[model samples]
Target: MSSSAGTSTQGEPLNATALNRQLKVMQDRINQLEAQLQAGSGAPRAKAGEGTPKERKRVKLSAPREFDGQQAALAGFLIQMQAYLHFYEDQFASEFEKVTYAGTRLVDKALTWFEPILKDYYENGDQATDFTKKVLNSYADFTEALSRVFGEKDEARRAQERLTHLRQTKMHFAATSTTTG
Candidate 1:
């Protein structure tokens, strides 16, 4: 049989080979473009300062979602309690200095209010104790009171942990310096 170039019924050229080659070239070009974009290697350059990226703000680390609602309510309650506790504690301190019993009963009453809140806080799964931070003065007063009245065991443990951490850090730095040198 003789080889002949044939046209289809519609009189159009039936160049299957040419169509396949063109399709393959187009596919290769598309794949190459995709690869470049994926690799971030051949993208269009951005104008300096015009499209310059801003430094991203650091995200605060959050506790597990389970504690979100309880934590917020606990924080508000703590703030309110802290303010009253501080006022009374200060009043008591002043009165004691003057050998007066004024506000003594009020201070005891305040302590009673705080007992359940503290118990629940310690019992919660995540012991995230730093709360009541809305008012700086109040928070500071509360923290001071906590250390004075309630945080003895925690304060001692924290101090000991800090000392150990400092010692370990010093040793690490010294070892690293020796190795590098």
Candidate 2:
């Protein structure tokens, strides 16, 4: 057999024997790693009651004590409503802009009704309990009313009436409570 010379593209003589030795060394290291992995011995083992150096102390977590069930229910209702609105918008993209505008107006009207109750709850500590009750009752009432309105033949008219009733009831309450006190 004739011995052939190996030369790089740059015309420099290449050491084939040295390259083969280096390749063998890398292959051996890879084989050793693979054997260790197969034996489940790649990582250092820690005995019982002698945890690994990188082990962290476990912590227990709990839900917030101040989370109100009623408030959570109300928030869930709002989230459901928002999801329904998004679905509606997707289904009727042609009329979505107008519907969104009307929805914003409705929300603004509702916020106007709610602002006083929130203000009263924040400003007067004594009235907070009463205001909270009012807010929760309003949420429950509105949910029921909305369900009923959606079930009716004239949903738009019924929805408008429901909103009007909510606004008028709160206004009347505010007027009566201020006069009485």
Candidate 3:
């Protein structure tokens, strides 16, 4: 309607002021879109229990209870330690960090067992050696050491008992099945 209205057609050129005004409008629209994107309001939001993917939350797990080498608690203690290490894997970037954290969770008899390895590693600097330092540096080695030192004392008896029970169960099932021949 007026000269300062929209763009002119029929080979009409836009003056600098109109061009600047159009640029300002475009820049303002761009700023609005950017703000909307940053605020997470531009995309349609999914309802509760919907399939909008979300970042996995990092749950803060309580520290594992101290392990005092009780045979019963050993398995549970190791499980807790493993869960702790797995959940906080990013925090423990190296095997040293993982093993050291596990070592700190030990107490009493467990602490006693870990002390020698800790001392050796600290005294030797790196944990790459095939000795005590190796155990201190590797999570797998450390867990294996713990299992060997504190695993079920009557493991053979327990396994044999399970096998005997399994054999009896198999015999019962075989007896119940009538063969048609």
Best by lDDT: 3
Q: lDDT order of candidates, best first?
A: 3, 2, 1
TM-score of each: 0.21, 0.23, 0.64
* True-vs-predicted CA distance for residue 33, candidate 1, Å: 1.9
lDDT string for model 3 (16-108, tens) is 787787778879988998888789986555565566334333457999999999888989999999998987787898998899999899999
> Candidate 3: lDDT over CA atoms?
0.80
Could you give candidate 2's per-residue lDDT for residues 1-181 as a string of tens digits?
A: 1133355555666577755765687799889988987898765555655774346343333211221223324445455554554544444444324233323333333445445545665587565765344443454444443334333457689789998887443534334434554
Q: Which candidate is the best by TM-score?
A: 3
Can you tell me which runs of candidate 2 are displaced by over 4 Å?
A: 1-106, 129-131, 136-181
Candidate 2 lDDT score at position 150:
35
* Better by lDDT, candidate 3 or 1: 3
lDDT of 2: 0.48
Q: How well is each residue in 122-175 modelled by candidate 1, as lDDT tens digits?
A: 475244354422112243544344334433446578888888887343434334
Q: Which stretches of candidate 1 lie over 4 Å from their true place?
A: 1-14, 42-61, 64-181
**Candidate 2 residue 1 C-alpha distance from true site, Å:** 47
Reference-based lDDT, each prediction: 0.44, 0.48, 0.80
> Model 1's lDDT to the true fold?
0.44
Clashes of each: 0, 0, 0
